[model samples]
Target: MSPKNLSALNKTHKLLLNKLKDKRTRQIYNKFEKYLNINENFAVAVSGGPDSLALSFLAKIYSIKNLLNVKYFIIDHKLRNNSTLEAKNVQKQLKKFSINLNILKWNGIKPKKNIQSIARDKRYELLLNETKKFKIKNILLGHHLDDLFENFFIRILRGSGLNGLISLDKKTQNNNINIIRPLLNFEKKDLTYISKFIFGFFVEDPSNEDDKFKRVKIRSFLKKLETEGLDKKKFLLTINNLKFSNETIKFYTKKNLLENTYFSEKKKLIILKESFFHHSAEVIFRSFTDVIKIVGKKYYPVRGKKIDSIIQLINNKSYFKVTLGGCVIKKVNQTVIVSKE
Candidate 1:
């Protein structure tokens, strides 16, 4: 490393290690290290919450121990009047521990509907831009076990399929940037413990208590279920089982793409032979979804219902052309053609 970078990293090392003297912090750090097991330089998205604050400390230790550079960022969506102030306060608190943070602002008009979802998308857009600026491939997030349960119930309520039910894996990639959640197995209480012991402060977002949001409502429902008879460990086992099933489907999906679909890279198109539809509906469904995502150059797959309609049309051996998810699907003779629109 250059002398300039080395000096800066040294400062960061001293600031984080000084706070790591606590036994609880060290214990959590060891667990985090085991889960992460990474030596590459990375970036972290901090929200000033206990979860994110705990993540920042753990990531700092990992970076210092591995001699890798890490940058911290706070996305100031400015949705609330005190959002920027809260971001600055969090920044000041981290600086005392030797961690510097940059606040990324969401500029321009904000969405009136789906406020939470839109804000989240904007936050990721800002964070991904930083990842490109630093040439970092991994961005750490602080989603704990409670969040895992919350997301599961949310997907269930939304009538999501198997994939969506278990989408929040430990490691997921989006738009070429890896989103790593190392704390998924840990509880929220543990993260809160870490933040209190290490920084002695953490910000609480009011939206978490707001019942108007679907997630908050689901969280409340989960609490009721727990009071009645929600065995968290058993519930987690169910999720693991579902994940295994999802993985099996993914395996076949890849196989179908490789064996049945022919791609013309030069033309940015895919040819789906009759044999492609020979597999089960589930396998073919996932395969088509993958093809559409690849051809359409979209990070997210097309909706399940829309994909189902296309599959039905193809199964009937009908000649039709339809555009969905930025891909145009046309039937010619016994073959199907999919190309970017």
Candidate 2:
């Protein structure tokens, strides 16, 4: 690169950093950085996409300014023919920024169903392996506001419960490794602007435009909604309100769990006695959902019909079992039991 071009790039980088040092970005970064602790050594998952690329750039700046150690990881699922080339390009870009990069490749057999989900699981597995090998505790992702909104709508469309509508958390613990999202408050458009103006980075994945993907369909639907005068700002405000409300409900739900539920560790069974059922059906339903979540099953709010069926089984003369999402709910003498079967 020419000296003049390098100087221009540096000027652009400074401008982009200053642009991101605003109220929203600062608030989000503070929450995220505190969770991941920008002062400590960490690893970032970079997929060479705009979101992750922006995160990588910001992480690099933060690490240098704070005298912290930060590493970059790119997982090659190797599902597509060009995955290797994409991974190599990501490594090349990180090298330009003087960031340490590691590429983890999946060389094993692929699963048969839902390749997207399978690839995501494999990607995280590779990340977990890296964290364990390097003894790194924090992992940063590039999930942005758009992603959260999309997730919220997706869950809603799928009849998900409050937990699903909660969308991506700012911080979570996965297998003892801390996962943090620093860009959740920033819009995808803002990240695109930063990537173009500062880093001169761009990525195009053909799969994103493929209409066969559920996410692509959702994106198109949301875009149409936007054109019909549905403001994303207002939608996000609704999500924020829903998130706060869900937290309050979860607080009570947790209390109910402590007071009403019993777990047989030896049998891996959870029991809810008749005394617990004396409360409102809403509470009972939420408690049931919570139990399912505790056992690592995805929770969807039970419809009135399903809830009625459960109530019938609970009140019946004969033992019966109801199953959903790999969770089994059984009626056992004066009590309702839930367990993984």
Assess every candidate by TM-score: 0.90, 0.74
Q: Native-vs-model 2 lDDT?
A: 0.74
Model 2 lDDT, residue 58, Cα: 73
Cα miss at 11, model 2 (Å)?
Answer: 16
lDDT by residue (tens digit), candidate 2, 128-189: 77887888988898899889978887878877777677758887666568788878888887
Candidate 2 weakest lDDT stretch, 10 residues: 295-304
Residue-level lDDT tens digits of model 1 in 1-341: 99997787678678678766778778888899999987788999999999999999888888778888889999999889998999999999998766889999998898989999778878888899889998999999999899999999888887888898987899977767889999998888889998998889999889999999999999899889999999989999999999998999989888999999899989999999889988888899889998998898766677788999899888786688999999899998789999989
Clashing pairs in 1: none
CA lDDT of 169 in candidate 1?
A: 94
Q: Global CA lDDT of candidate 1, please?
A: 0.89
